[model samples]
Target: MICNVFTQSIKRKYLVLAFVLVCGLTIMVSYYKPISHRYMFLPDTQVANLNFYDQNVISGFVFGKGTPMAVSCPLLLSGNKQEMLVAQSFKRTTRIPSFYYSYLAKNCSLFKSRRNYITSSLTLEEEQFPIAYSMVVYKDVEQVERLLRSIYRPQNIYCVHLDNKSEPEFRETLTEITNCFQNVFVSKESLDVRWGTMSVLEADLICMHELWKYKSWKYFINLTGQEFPLKTNAEIVGILKNLNGKNNIRKSVLNRWATRWEKAGKAPAGIIPVKGDLQIAVNREFVDYVLHNKTAKKFLKWCSKTKVPDETFFVSLHYNKHLKIGGSYTDDQGNSTDPPYITRFKTWEGTAKPCHGKYVRRVCVYGVGDLPLLINRKELFVNKLHLDFEPLALDCLEETLYNVTRNEYFQTLEGNGPPKHT
Candidate 1:
């Protein structure tokens, strides 16, 4: 009887051990099952243990056919450390002011300062570098030279796409200079053919789509070549179109910047810049509203079929959405004081371009063209400021914009996010 009881206990112990092993195996299979099949192009994401599916390989594809292969998996945004992607359109600023590197070195993220800063473009190498998506179109040799001196640096990740129509020699010359810059990336695009509203907008969208590949940024800002940054206030107020968040600056956006235009015998309606107004700084959602959303696309398509009027394109959508976006172009006193965007405009010299060379000396305006400022009373962005006027632009950036960017970085660190405007 004693032997029988002992044998029974041993048998039960063995059975329990077997069960535990099987359970462990099952868990392991569940954990790594996703790794079995490979995904060729995984979209930028912030998830671990991602799901995987098998590859399909039937015959050649036909029109309207075999379910277009899914390219992107559902993105899981990382709420932990949000970042921004600044899409800057630049020709080159090598001849610009002296303090460019000084500004970035002092204020921009210094991942290199810490041990083990991965400089490689591939993998999770970079710590917190903001991806600067720069579209390069028709930069004079002088401008390109100036850029090498001023803004081109390792910290900046540039998606520098030049127009395809540019002379090969120009590309060759630019590439030589670009090669000198350690982190400068060169890209070419076949988009020179279209300068219309849809074309320009499409290129802008294309730049964003390409930019999305490099960095995982929370917001993307469209920057111009001539545009300078005067101030970047850290304390941003959300113009919450998402009203539950407490910001509603969307009320101020004015849609009709123009009066009715007479179509001049097949010459596409010519609409002048609204006195002093230019483009807007709408949010990512609003941007997508015009670019991707179905209803918005339909509206844009209808517009494209006609004059493809840019004025109505943005304004109409903002009106259609009945949405309020957020961004502050003002200072504490409600003064328009974004530093980089601010400038001391001299009287316009006689030239085809709005901004000719550079202001050699500060003179009061008695001119053909006047300096333009945004509706918020803030200066929109300057044109014509170049290597010649580098000192002034540099001073403006150092004293004003750089400080704001620094503060903004800290504010982000401290948990307050980006500022908003209409």
Candidate 2:
């Protein structure tokens, strides 16, 4: 009877072991199972991961009917010691600026020192294209200063448009900051920018007109104060050179919602209305035509009466055949073809929403976990970075873009054969 009991106990042990192994296998399979399969194309995302799917297939697996296929997965970062340090620095800077700006304003030398510390670390590259930038900013003075530092190059020019509605202290701080940099200037004509109004377009138009005075800039890129450059100025110069005079603008269909301007009797005939975001990069010739051409002026006037002229003005200018500049690459449908759309990376409302960061007013505020994704992206600039939401994101970008150690990282990628320039 004792022997029988021992055999039964041994059998029970084996049964328990088998059950644990089966449970482990089940858990592993569940972890990796395809959560969902859906079409994705993140035109505004930092990385355009569209190479995986073909535009001709219908299976949506090995084949798909899309220009590019992008399947997004969850992204999360493990907070390391260094990342925490950067986060701490961001907190300190954001807090102290508000409290100390009054005293700093009275003391010029101290103010200069603080400004120098941020700008001095950046090293501009040689043989770089003279890029022109117009950044429209309202609040977030500290954030804008950080962005300027990251993208500052002696060769390029910057036009900053501070909203006329901004507080006096914000205006004073921006003036003091720009006073130190010769290439940087505060737009003399500051517009009171509003959502869904022509004023937004007017602010950019004012900057473009100002930037046009200097004939040296090769390409005109627009920015809001929240954007930061992912690629160095040197890398961007290489991209523009290869483009050979092509512009990067996002194109979209103008449906009923887009036709609001037309319904309101703001759109004009002989001008085909297209839709795109205000963020874009255009050549000097394009800028001149938009500012001076009679046709463009009439279109502008009509658009000013529209709901959101910013979206219509540039798209119309780009596709307008009357301009006689065949700069825009049109598809078979006669729309702008796979334009590089690289001036700024953004996350909009859709299936591929950013799972790794917080969203404010329906826009993703990128964080450190999103760094790997941003770095891998082909775009030169990424936008809407608020220090309050994700300080480490900007901090890591500074460390990677400006720090000496980054040279090695760049060298390796180049040595391994850098991806074709965007």
Candidate 3:
């Protein structure tokens, strides 16, 4: 009787173990559902529900260029009509719930976790050509992400400045994206950015101050979230190197007389006031001058009370003969200042009426129609590309840039020459 009782106890333990294993396997299978039939990666020939074949309508939220982007999509709730409907609605209208972020966070490991960047180029040699960026964005997470991806390189440092007045969700989304990459970070100080106000300059200055601690960076460029690079990272780095230590801040031809600036009581004695669209790319020495120079500090204080300080501040600082950083102070041979000014392509609403899209705040929203003009221009970057307004333009531009880079890289591998000119 004792032997029979022991045999039954052993049988019960085996049965319990089998049940536990079955349950664990079921949970694992349920957690990782198959990707949706309607989903496919971009630039592929497959026709998913995303309309990937539609060259004009495909979304620009692609995760990979040449790298593999592992994506997981869940359509398990499809059997439930109500849940499916809600999910579809969100995907169409807001895209707030999608597999994009999962892939972005997991497979896109191009970013470095520390200041020490590692380069893995197959053709080009590993070199430290770190560029610092100050990108001030208030909204449009999709566009911002697109811009960041298009310009992202492991060697560069990016400081994102979010407006204090932005919605909580918007701020959180940006923070989450930036947190995934160590090279990209939210500025320690955020300002309530007001249009045509000094707050814009202040926000950029805060980012500049933070980036200054990394003395290895060679150049700094300020951008809004709406901008996209026309040149590849290698091309941009080459351009900066050719600058040979000069700054590229656009000097305004609008302000002519010293009296006009004097009337505002902001112009320093014997300092000429200048204006530009306010985008600037400068060398480390130029940044140092603006940050530590007593005159530049006084100029900043004076511009605080002036109208549209961003338009005038950087240009004025760059052109200051006392600073001797910009082309104005250099020789006229043009060799000292290659491809003068911060050449960013921006179309004003008053002039270019946006052939394919609407104007936002007197600035043309570039579209597919503007591609010829934009591509032919000698600008390093183009401004005011909103995904909601003209997604195709960004897509086409990205494709063009990718092809150019790929061709150049492959040519280098074939013993042709270094990647340049595209």
Q: Give the whole-model CA lDDT for all candidates, comma-separated.
A: 0.36, 0.66, 0.66
For 397-419, candidate 3 gives per-residue lDDT tens digits of: 76566656667677777898666
> By descending lDDT, how would the candidates be arranged?
2, 3, 1
C-alpha lDDT of residue 290 in model 3: 80
Q: What is the lDDT of candidate 3?
A: 0.66
lDDT of 2: 0.66
Clash pairs, candidate 3, are none
TM-score for candidate 2: 0.70
Local accuracy of candidate 1 as per-residue lDDT tens digits, 1-422: 99999999999999999999789768855653232222222233411212110111111011111222221001101111111011011122223121222222332233132111223322121223233435444545434433332333244445555656766655555565455444555654546624445565555555555555554333344443444433332212122222221211222234453332223122112212211211444445554554566665665555454343543455445433233323322233545333232222223345343431234343222111121121122432233344334232222232233334445455555766544444
State every prediction's TM-score relative to the real structure. Answer: 0.41, 0.70, 0.73
Error (Å) of candidate 1 at residue 348 is 10
Query: Lowest-lDDT window of 10 residues in candidate 3?
Result: 68-77
Error of 3 at 196 (Å): 0.8
Superposed model 2: Cα runs more than 4 Å off: 1-128, 264-266, 330-338, 404-422
